[model samples]
Structures are given as structure tokens and as C-alpha cells.
Target: MYAVLSVTDKTGIVEFGAGLRKLGASLVATSGTAGLLRDAGMDAAVIGDLSGVPEMMGGRVRAFHPSVFGGLLYRRGNASDEAEAHQHGIPRIDVLACNFKDLVADDGIAGALDSIDIGGPAMLRAAAKNFPSVLPVVDPADYGEVLRALGAAGGEVAAVDPAFRRSLAAKAFGRTCAYDRSIQRILDTTGDRE
Candidate 1:
């Protein structure tokens, strides 16, 4: 019924968010992404606003809170989980959209360090781990497919096949692996120079 978005790729996000809005889904996004959604005429709340934790460490730490993970990780049919979620005011996040910042060749150490996303991979993994309850989208290319699925199901991604959800999860893992490898390369290179 709700979704979270924290993406570096703005391509097609506006259209995707707008499509979701039409399906009556609320959006939670990082500050920068939220502003872009609003500019595109889709109302999106900042992720910090939902968790009541402002971005700290120069916007590097914001999405790892209980509220965010609880929403994505809660078991759909578990009464205990439901009770705990309600007690903590953790709303269910049916979808999570994120595309990590790409470390460009021209970007020096400063830029590469900043480009390494801490919360994004965590979010993607969580949502993928809880698929059927949460759909994790890590590529801009998948926007249309998601929107179409939402539209077909009248906003309920539960209608999607479990196989498809697994595929999505697999893709998310692949992306996270590549991202972590990139960060590792950076650390190795830095250490070499040191």
C-alpha cells in the first residue's frame, strides 16, 4: 500500500511515482529525491520525516532505522509482527525503489567516497528478502514493469507471481554484489596508495 524510494537515478522516477500515486500509493523518499518527486507533481515525504531521524553524517545515514526496516521486514501474516508494527507505528512498505550512485571514472577519491551508498543496498536487500510483501526495484529500466504490474493489480503487488518476485530479488542481490565490489576496489586502491 506504500512505497519508499531512495534513488540516484532520476530518470523516469517522476513518471513512476506519478503512476503509483494514481494507484493510491503513498511515497517516502530521501530529501533530494522527494524534492524531485514534488517538482514532478507527485507528493513524496522525506524518509527522515517518516522515521523522525534527520539525515546525519552528511546525509550518509538516514534509511537504516527501525521504522524503515520494520515496515519492509515485517511478516505479512504474522499477528505478532502486526501487533509489534502497530505498536511502533511502522507502516508496511509494499515497494522499495533505489538505484545507487555510480562511481564515475573521472570522480576522484572524494566523489567516489560520496558515491558509495550505505543505506541503498540495505534497503534493497531487505525489500528483496521480504518479497510478495515488499518489491525491491534497483534499476530504472524496471520502472515501467513495476508501474504496469501495479496498474494491473490495482496497486497490490501481491498479485505478482512469486517467481517474478524471486527474479527481482535475484537482480537486487546481483546489484548489491556489484556495488560492494566497487567499494572494495576503492578501498584496495586507496590502501595501495597509502
Candidate 2:
């Protein structure tokens, strides 16, 4: 199974990606995430290779391709989805580990907020939308649970656990909602309120 790891948090990501890799899952990550994995001597491919798009605007435009979305959005049981994925060379992304930038009051929060990532949220939402086929993880705390599930089910648990899937979808929506709230707060404080 393929796992997409595009997190701004950068907490426990190296260990999480390594664990996923150890379980025979392929890792697709963005710039900083790829760097973190590589720095920890883990094999991680850049998301651009998977999506065919360079991360532009200081890495804000990553993972915004049809390749990315198709992999995350395609239904596993649909023959047409499988055919289209095969035709476009898009692999199914079974797991997505993503966390948005924390909108906290810090020295780098301003610049980081500027690169808070629209595409990442969209990808998370799409993966969450297709949660029955994909497992979306938003919190670092759930890494071990996912690892345990993957271990127990031989990497095929995405199809068997409706409660787990729903929990992931709920987290995905919460992350997006928090992200939007952060942006709104920033706008309000910066006099960009509308």
C-alpha cells in the first residue's frame, strides 16, 4: 500500500514514515517531509515525482495534481476507477498522514502561516472523503494505532474497520476546520477581516 506523508508539524514524522516503510508501505512526501525522512536515512520519494508538479510559491503548491487526487479519491471497487488509475499510472494511496501548520503565536508563525498549504488541505479532504478506501491520519498520536492495525491486518485494515475509518474522517474535517479558523484569526488580527 502507498502512504502519503505531507505534514507541516514535523513531529515524529521520521519515526512514523520509517515504521510505515518497515511495514512495506511506499512513502510519498513533500519537500521538508522528504528531507526529514532522508535525513533520518529513510527512503522517501518526493511528491513532485508522484504528482508531476514542482512545489511553487515557497512550497505552497505541492500535491495539487490530478495524479495526487486520483490516487486519493478513486474508489477501490469501481472498475472505472481502476482503469483510469492504470491508464494514468496513478497508484492507490491507502494511507495519508497529514497535519496542518500550527497557528500558534511564535516567531516563525507569520511566514509559516503564509505557507500553510491549500493543496495539502484539499488532498486531506479528498482522502477523507474516500476514507473507506484510504486511512487518513491527522494526529501524531494515532501513528502507533495505525501501525498496530497495519501489523495485525497485514496492511489490509482499511477495508475492515468502519469505526477507524470514521474516526479518521472526523479528524480530517477537524483539521481543516482548525486550519480555517486559524486563517480567520490571523486575518482578523491583521486587519484583513472581511
Candidate 3:
């Protein structure tokens, strides 16, 4: 199983990543996140490794690749999807653990603009949209519960309940919606002062 983790807020990420690794999940993470996981003594593949592009454009271009999205969004049962995925060498991303930078909490226009996360939200939404095949985890608090669920099923990703996956998808959508609203509000207020 493959788990993609690209969280800006690294509250309990190391422990969670370690737990996932112990459960036989290969971890693919953003550059900083991968470094942290490695420092914690857990090996994690960098997102760039999957994307075939080094993190460039001020590290903003990470995870905006077909390999990442294809892995998250590939349909399990569809023959064409399976063939395309195999053709592109896309591995299935069974789990996504991500959190966006908080635009609402930024102190100023510069901070807000800087906090506008693009790739993170896109990946989260893709995982959520494909929730039946991928587990979407937006909040750090959900880490323990997900680990427990996976553990209960002996690390089988498909063993997670459909209802639970739906709930996680809802949460992922909620977070992305709130994040977009925050960005809109900031832009609106910024324009008013201009």
C-alpha cells in the first residue's frame, strides 16, 4: 500500500508516518515532510521521486503531477483506467494525509498570499473524490483513528468501512471549502484597501 503525506502542519506526522510504515505502507511525502520522516528514522520516498521533477518554483510545484493524481484518482475496477495506470506506471495511493496552509490565520496580505496552498488542496480533493479507493485524511486528529482502523484490518486498506471513508471524504471537502473561503475573503478585503 502507498500513502502520500504532504502536510504543512507537522504536529503528529512523524509518529503517524512511522505507524503507517510499520503497517507496511510505503510513504511518499513532500520534500520537507520526507526529510522529517527520515530524521525520525523512517524512510520516505520524496514526491519529486514519483513526479520525476525536483521541487522547483519555490517548492510550490511539488505534487502537481500526473503520477500523484493518477495514483489517487485511478479507478480500481475499470479496465481502461487500469490499463492507463499501468501504462503510466502509476501506483495506487491508498492513503492521503494532508493539511493545507491556513490562509485565514495569516497576519497580513503577504502572509495570506504566501499561505495560499494549491497542490495540497488539489491532492486532498482528488483523494476525497476517490474515497472509495483511497483514504483521505485532512486533519492531524484523524491520524490515530485511521491507524486503528488499518490495524484492525491487518493493514488491508480495503478493509476500512465505506462509511468511514465517506466521512473522511466529507471532512476533506469541508477543509478545502473553508480554505478556499479564507482565500476569497482575504482577496476581497485586500482589494477593498487597494
Candidate 4:
């Protein structure tokens, strides 16, 4: 099993990652996130390492690769998707724990614009879109619930309740939508609405 985790909010992440590790899931994360996990004595693969693409553009272009999205978007039971995934060596991403930067941060206009997360929302949406196979976790508060569900299913993602996954997916979409709205508001106030 694989879990991709990237977040601007670091609350409860180490514990959540630990739970996932205990459940036999391999952890993949952005460089900063991976460093924190490693400091916590947990093994985590850097996103660049998994995607075969180094973090570039001051880390803005880290997780926007096909390798990462392919893992999250591919249909589980579709033979063509499976074959293409195998051909590309993209592992199945069974879980995604992601949260974006808060636009409310006391950063200036340039900083606030930078805080408009791209990769986080993209990955979250792709995982949520494939909720039948992927578990999308948007909030840290729900980490324990997800861990419990995975534990109850014996760490078998396929055995997890579809309703639960669907609910998480819905939450993921809601989060992204709110994030975009915040960005739009910021841009509007700055007189640079696009």
C-alpha cells in the first residue's frame, strides 16, 4: 500500500504517518514533509524520488507529474489502466493526506499568491475522483478516523467501506473549493483578479 502526504499544515502529521507506517503503508511526501517524517524516525520517500523529477521552481512544481497523478487516477479494475500503470512503473496510491496553505496567513500579496497551492489541490482532486480505490484525507482532525478504518479493514484498502471513502472524497473537494474561493478573494482585494 502507498500513501502520498503533502501539506502546509503540519498538525498531527507525524502521528498519522506513524499509524500508516504501522499499517504497512509506504510513505511518499514532498521534501520538507519527508524530512519531518524522517526526523520522527519514519521512512518516507521524497516525491521527487518517486516521480523521477527533482523539485524545481522554488518547489512549486514538485507533485505536478504524471507519475504521481497516474497512480491516483487510474481505474482499479480496468485492464488497460493497469497495464499502462505497470508499463510506467507507477505504484497504486491507496491513500492521500493533503492540506493546502491558509490564505489567512500574515504574508504580503506576493507571499499570499505563492501560498495559493497548486500541487496539493491537483493531487487531492485526482485521488478524490478515484475514491472507489483511493482514500482522500483533507483534514488532520480526521486522521484518527482514517487510521481506525484502515485498522478495522486489516490495512486492506479494498476492504474499506466505499461510503467512508466517498465521504472523504466529498470533503476533499469541499476543501479545494474553499481554498480557491479564498484565493479569488485575495486576488480581488489586491485588484488583480484574474
Local distance difference test, per candidate?
0.85, 0.83, 0.89, 0.90
lDDT of 4 by residue, 1-194 (tens): 89999988999999999999999999999888899999999999999988999999988889988789999999998999999999989889889999986586356568787767899999999999999888999999999999999999998777898889889999999999998888877766764332
Q: In what order do the candidates fall by TM-score, top score first?
A: 4, 3, 1, 2
- Per-candidate TM-score against the hidden true structure: 0.92, 0.89, 0.93, 0.94
Supply the TM-score for candidate 2.
Answer: 0.89
At residue 183, what lDDT does model 4 achieve?
A: 80
Residue 128 lDDT (model 1): 91
After TM-score superposition, the amount by which residue 194's alpha carbon in candidate 2 deviates from its true location, in angstroms, is: 13
Model 4 ranges off by over 4 Å: 105-109, 192-194
RMSD (Å) of each candidate, 1 decimal: 1.8, 2.7, 1.7, 1.9
Relative to the true structure, candidate 3 has a C-alpha RMSD (angstroms) of 1.7
* Candidate 3 lDDT, 1-194, residue by residue in tens: 89999988999999999999989999999888999999998989999888798888897788888899999999888899999999999988999999976566445577676668899999999999998889999999999999999899788767788899899999999999998998888887775332
Candidate 2's residue-wise lDDT over 1-194, tens digit each? 78999888888888899888988998999878988899899888888888778878777677878888999999997999999999999888988998877464333446546655688789889999998888889999999888887777788746447888888899999989888888776655654322
3 or 4: which has the higher lDDT? 4
Write one digit per residue (lDDT tens) for candidate 1, span 42-150.
Answer: 8899998889999999988999899999999999889999999999999889989988864543455676777778898999999999987788999889889888877
